[model samples]
Target: MLLQIKRLSSSYGRVRALNGVELNIEEGELVALVGANGAGKSTLMRAISGVQPTNGGGIWFDGADITKVSASKRVRLGISQVPEGRQVFSEMTVEDNLLLGAFTRPRLEIDEDIEKNYVLFPVLKERREQLAGTLSGGEQQMLAIGRALMARPKLMLLDEPSMGLSPLLVDQTFQTIQKLAESGMTIFLVEQNAYVALSIATRGYVMEGGRTVLEGTGQELLDDERVKKAYLGV
Candidate 1:
């Protein structure tokens, strides 16, 4: 396994957010965690990324235990997260925001990585000198993903890449994720759009009220009657 979460549990004061959630993802696999609001999907991503502290659990990545690792160190260890909101610096240029993602690396590598990101996101290339705050919602989301990629991560955690977008933009975002997966990027996606998510994911888990209630191949989940009734609305 490239990533594993064993009996993960977390709480926000008296509110228990995650209840012994368990999950696993293989290298280069695209996995999705789908759930409704307040299902603890974002909390799970935060725990894996080492931002939100866990009460009790183990997070193993690339065969090493990172449960207690610092968030910055985790990024250096090849774990990067594109947070739920497209948290781009509005005043900063697109290139500058991307450069921030490579802060842990040497200065020389940062330039190289920025060029690579530009190639991956041609729109960003055109807006390289433009302020990130000026981009459209979908474009900003793309920039967020691009910024995360700048870190050269072995495992990328994404929180709701499709949130707050038009139908057309949503389709484009899913296509971009599929392209990334085809290029051998390992991804753990937290999304509310179950249908689109499962379509691109290799495997998936369903969360309800801070617990993982279902696990299976993406196709299996898509075909599941329960999943259809609740999430897919089929």
Candidate 2:
């Protein structure tokens, strides 16, 4: 396994958010976690990224235990997260914001990575000098993903990448995710859109009230009657 979460649990004071949640992802695969509001999907992602402290359990990445590592250290260890909100710096130029992603790397490599990101996101290239705040909602999301990619991660944790976008943009974003997976990126996706997520994912898990209630191949979950009634609305 490229990543492993063993009996993971987390809490916010008295509120228990995760209860012995277990999950695993292999290298070069796209795994989707789908759930409704307050399902603890985001909490799971934060725990793996080393931001939300785990009350118990272990997080192992690339054969090393990182259960107590800092968030910055996790990023350096090839784990990158594009947070729920596309938190790009509004005042900085698009290129500058991307440069921040590579702050852990040497100065010479940062410039090279910025050029690589532009190639990956052509729209960003055209507006490299423009402030990130001025971009459209979809464009900003792209920039956010690009910023994470700047770190050259082995595993990318995505939280609701399709949130607040038009249907067209949503399709585009999912397509980009598919392309990334095809190019050998390991992605652990947390999304509310069960239909779209399952379509692109190789395997998936369903979370409800801080617990994983279902796990199967993407097609199996899509075809499950319970999943259809609750999530797919079929």
Candidate 3:
């Protein structure tokens, strides 16, 4: 496994957000996590990235235990998260925001990473000098993904990359993700669009409240009676 979470639990003050959640991702696999709002999807992502405190359980990444690792250190260790809400630095130029993602790397490699982003998102190249705040929602999401990619992560945690976008943009975003997966990026995706998520994911898990209630291949979840009724609206 490229990443592993065993009995991971997280809480907000006194409110528990994750209840012994367990999941893993193999190298070159895109694993989707689908659930409703308040299902602890984001919490699980945060815990894996070490931003959220784990009340119990362990997280192992790339053969090392990282349950107690700092968030910045996790990034340096090749774990990158494109957080929900596409929280790009609104005041920074697109290029500047992107450069920040490679802050820990050698300065010589920064330009190369930026060029790779340009190849992935041509619009970013055109708007490289523009303030990040001016981009559309979909554009910002793309920028967020680009920023994370600048880290050249081995495992990427994507929290709701399709959260707020037009239908067409959502499709476009998903296509980009699919391409990323095809290229062997290990992606752990947290999404509310169960139908679309399960369609592209190699494997998937369904969450309810704070627990993982189901796990299977994408096609299996899409056809599952409970998942179809509660999530896919089948």
Candidate 4:
């Protein structure tokens, strides 16, 4: 497995956010986690990225234990996160933001990686000199994904990629995600949009009350009666 979460639990001050959450992602698989608001989906993503403190259980990546690893070290270990809000550097130019994602790399290697991202997101190249804040929401979302890609992560943790997008933009965003997966990037996606998440997922898990309540192939979850009623609105 590329990633593993064993009975993981996390909290925000007094309230628990994740409780005994078990998940695994194999290499090159596109895995999706679907849940409702406050289902602790983002918290789990945070825990996996080593940004959130886990009160219990373990996080293992590529056969090593990294439950106590710092977030930056985790990034060096090939994990990167694109947070829910496209939290790009508003005042910085688009190229600057992409440049920052390669902070750990050698200076000579950064430019080449940036060029790779521009190919993935040609619009970002067009806006290379423009301030990131000036882009439209869809463009900003693309920028967010591109920024994370700049890290050259083996596993990308995406939190709500479809959030706040129009129906058209959502389709486009998921298409981009699908393409990334098709290119063999291991992706762990957390989304409130169950249908969209499952549609492109190779396998999926359902989170509720901070626990994983279901697991199956993406189509199986989509066909599941319980999933249909609670998440898919079937």
Candidate 3 global lDDT: 0.93
Query: Which candidate leads the pack in lDDT?
Result: 4
Per-residue alpha-carbon lDDT of candidate 2 for residues 128-177, written as tens digits (9 for 90 to 100): 89999999999999999999998999999999999999999999999989
Tens digits of per-residue lDDT for model 4 on 1-234? 999999999989989999999999999999999988999999998888888999999999999999999999999999999999878998999999998888866799898989888888899999999999999999999999988888889999999988889999999999999999999999999999999899899999999999999999999999999999999998
Q: List TM-score per model, in order.
A: 0.98, 0.98, 0.98, 0.98
Deviating ranges (above 4 Å) for candidate 4:
none
TM-score of 2: 0.98
Q: What overall lDDT goes with each candidate model? A: 0.92, 0.93, 0.93, 0.93
Off by over 4 Å in 1: none
Better of 1 and 4 by lDDT: 4
Worst 10 residues of 3 by lDDT: 46-55
Model 2 stretches astray by more than 4 angstroms: none
lDDT of 1 by residue, 1-234 (tens): 999899999999989999999899999899999989999999999988888989988899899999999999999999989999878988999989999988788888888888888888899999999999999999999999999998999999989998899999999988988999999999999999999999889999999988899999999999999999999999
Model 3 Cα RMSD, Å? Answer: 0.7
Clash count per candidate? 0, 0, 0, 0
Point out the worst 10-residue segment of candidate 4 by lDDT.
Answer: 100-109
